[model samples]
Target: MTTRFFLTSAATTLLAAIACGPAHAAPDLEAAQAIVDEHSQIPTFEPPGEPFDAKACMADKKLFSVPTSSSIPFVDGIETSMEEVAEEIGFEFQQWKNQAQPTQWVQGMEFAINNGFDGIDLMAGIIPSSLGPQAAAAKAAGIQVFATHWADTTTPDDPAATHSFPIPYTRVGEIIGAWITVKTEGKANVLIIGSDDVPATTPYRKSVQATLDKLCDGGCSHTYVNVPVAEWATKIQTNVQGALIADPTINYIVPIYDSMSQFVLPALTITGKKGQVKIATFNGTPFVIDLVRQGEVEMDIGESLGWIARSTIDAEMRSLCGLDVPEDLYVPLLIFDKDNAETAGVPAGFNQGYGDEHVSGYRKLWGLE
Candidate 1:
C-alpha cells in the first residue's frame, strides 16, 4: 500500500536513463578485475590496547533492537542474531517490529525510552524517518543508540552512531556490478530493481553505475525501477514483468536486495521469463541460495548472519560502556555463483549461513572466551 513511484509517468516511460546506460558493449574483463583487486580487502577488528570489563559493562543492562520488518528473512536473520548474542552476553534483548507507518518510527523510540532500556539498536527500518531528535533524546537520557545496515544511509547527520558500523554496502554494489560486467563479457542490459524508500539504495545504485561505466563500456544499457518497501509485493511483479516486456534485451536482473526474489521471481515465472533473465543480488538469503544451488538464480553476495549479529552486539557494548572501540568494524562479504555455490560459495550441507568465526572471535576479544 505504501509503494511509491520515482516518476509520475512510470508506466509510459519507465526507463529513466542514467549516465552509464546499459550498453551491450564488448566484455571488459580488465575493468572488472581491476575493481575486484582494488576493493577485495576488508578491515579486521582486534581488541583495544586497554581492555574493559564486558561482563561488568553488560551487567543488568538491557538492549533493544528493532527492525522495520522482522518477517523479511534477511531482517529476521539479523533479529535472530541480536537475540542469540544477548543470551551469550547476559543482557535482555527485545525487538519492536510494529512496521510503523509515517512517523511511527519516532513514536516507537519514544515508547522504548519510556520503557527504560539501557541501549537500543535501531535497525534499517527507521533510517529515513525523523530519528534525529529521537536519537539525541536517547543519548541525553544516557541510552546508547546504534543502528545497523542503515548507520550511514541518507541520514548524513547520524545521531550518536557507533564507529563499529560494518558492512560496506557501497563496496557490495560495486562487486555485483563488476560481476555482471565479467559475466556478461561486457554487454549487459541490466534491469536494476531498487527501493528509493530505503535511502541506502542511493549509494548502492551509484556504485553499480560506476561499474557499468567501466566494464559495460561495450554498450551496456540499464533501466532503474524504484519500488518502496511497503509496495514491493504487489508492485514488483507487475513492474518487473513490464520492464522485461518493454525491453526483452535485458539479460540480467539485479535486485539491490535479493529478498525481492520472494515477489520478483514469481513474476518471472508468471510472465514466462524465468530463464530469460538472470538474477544477482545482495543478502544471500537461504531461499536465494537454494535458487543458486538449483540453477534458478545466478549470483549471490552474502554476509554471515551470525557474524553480523556478533559484530553488531560488539558495537553496542562498546558504545554503552564508553570504550574506545574501532569505527567501521569490517564484516566479511562472500560471493556465491551457481558454479561455486555448492563447493565454495556457501559450501555443502552448511545451510545458507556463514561460519561463526566472529562469534568466537568476539568472545576472545572481550575476554569472555
Candidate 2:
C-alpha cells in the first residue's frame, strides 16, 4: 500500500484559529497549538564561523556512489527523507520492510549485507533480541548501520552494535502523560495499549507510568493492556468493548501509536460511548488527527518529521564515508491535539498533502531542498 504525506486545509484553518486565540485554552488544545506555532516559526541560527561548503559535501563522489538499504518502504517520513537525501546526494537506495516482525528483521539485514550495500537504515519494529544480532552482523560486515523507530541495544563495548540513534521514547511517554493529565484534569483512568514484547515500547510504558506517579498527586488510575502482535485489532476491539461494558465510568484511553487505536474505535462504538471516552495517542497520523478534530481523541504526540529518516541516513552515510559516529541520536517530538493536529501536517491516511509539499519543510533542514 502506498502512503502519501501532507497537511490539509482543514488543519491549516484549525491552526490559524488557534494561533489567533488566547494562549490559555484547554490544556490539550493549548499544547497542540503551541506545537503549531513553534513549527511555523523559523529558527535564527548563529552565523557559521567557518564557511561550510554544501558543494564540497555534495561533490564527495564516494558519498554519491554509496549504496544504502533502508529498513522500511519509502512511504512515511522516513521514506520521504530518504528520497530527498538520495536526490540531493545521488546515492542508490534500497528499501526493505520487516512487516513489523522479528524474523523479517533478520532476513532484511542479511539481505542488505549480501547485496553489497554500503549502509543499512534499520526501521524494523522494536525487537531487542533481533537488533543486537543484526547490528552485530552489519558491523562485522563493515556495513554502515542507521536505525529508525527502534531502540539500539548496542552499548559502547559492542563493536558489532556500533553507530546508532534511538527515538526519544521516554520523552514521548512523558509528553503523552503530561497532555493526558492536563486534559483529564489529573483524574485519568487510562487504558494504555501496546505490544509488551518489544523492548522499544517498554520505555514509553515506563515513562508514562513514571510521569503519572510523579505528576498525579492524587494518584491517577491506569491499566496497561498488552496488544498481541497477531489478531491485535480483534483483541483490542474486544478488550476495549469489554472494559467499557464492565466500567461505564472509564474515561481515558492511551494508545502508544495511533494506528493501533483504530482497533479500539469499534469497541467504543459498540459500547455506545464513542465520543464520551477521551483518547490520547502517539504519532499524529492522519486518522488520529481527524479523531482529535472531531473530539474523539483528546491529544497526541506527533513523531518528528525527517528526524527518523535523516538519522537513519546520517548513520549509514557517516559509516560509508568513515566519519566519526555517535552511539545514539534522538529525534525531536511534537504534541498534537484538535487545535494543532491540522497545522503540523497530518499523515497520509487523512488525505492531506498531495506529495510534493508533504515533507519539503523537514527535508530542507537536511540540505535536501
lDDT of 2 by residue, 1-369 (tens): 999978799998888878876333223445533433553332322211122223244353222111112221223445655666666656666555434555666677778777776666655344333467776776687665654456523322223434445566776777777766666665677778877654467778878877765555544677787875555656888888888888777888887767667788888888898888878777656666666766777776655445445445555554555555545553444556665556645443322321223245434533555
lDDT per residue (tens digit) for residues 101-212 in model 1: 5466667678778889988777754562357778788878878777677633333635454332535777888888888888777778888898877757878877787778
Off by over 4 Å in 1: 1-27, 34-52, 100-104, 151-157, 160-166, 343-353
Listed in order, each prediction's TM-score against the native is 0.83, 0.72
- Evaluate model 1: give its lDDT: 0.71
lDDT of each: 0.71, 0.58
Which 10-residue span in candidate 1 carries the lowest summed lDDT? 344-353
Best by TM-score: 1
How many clashes in each candidate? Answer: 15, 3
* Clash list (residue pairs), candidate 2: 6-353, 11-342, 165-329
Alpha-carbon shift of residue 267 in model 2 (angstroms): 1.1
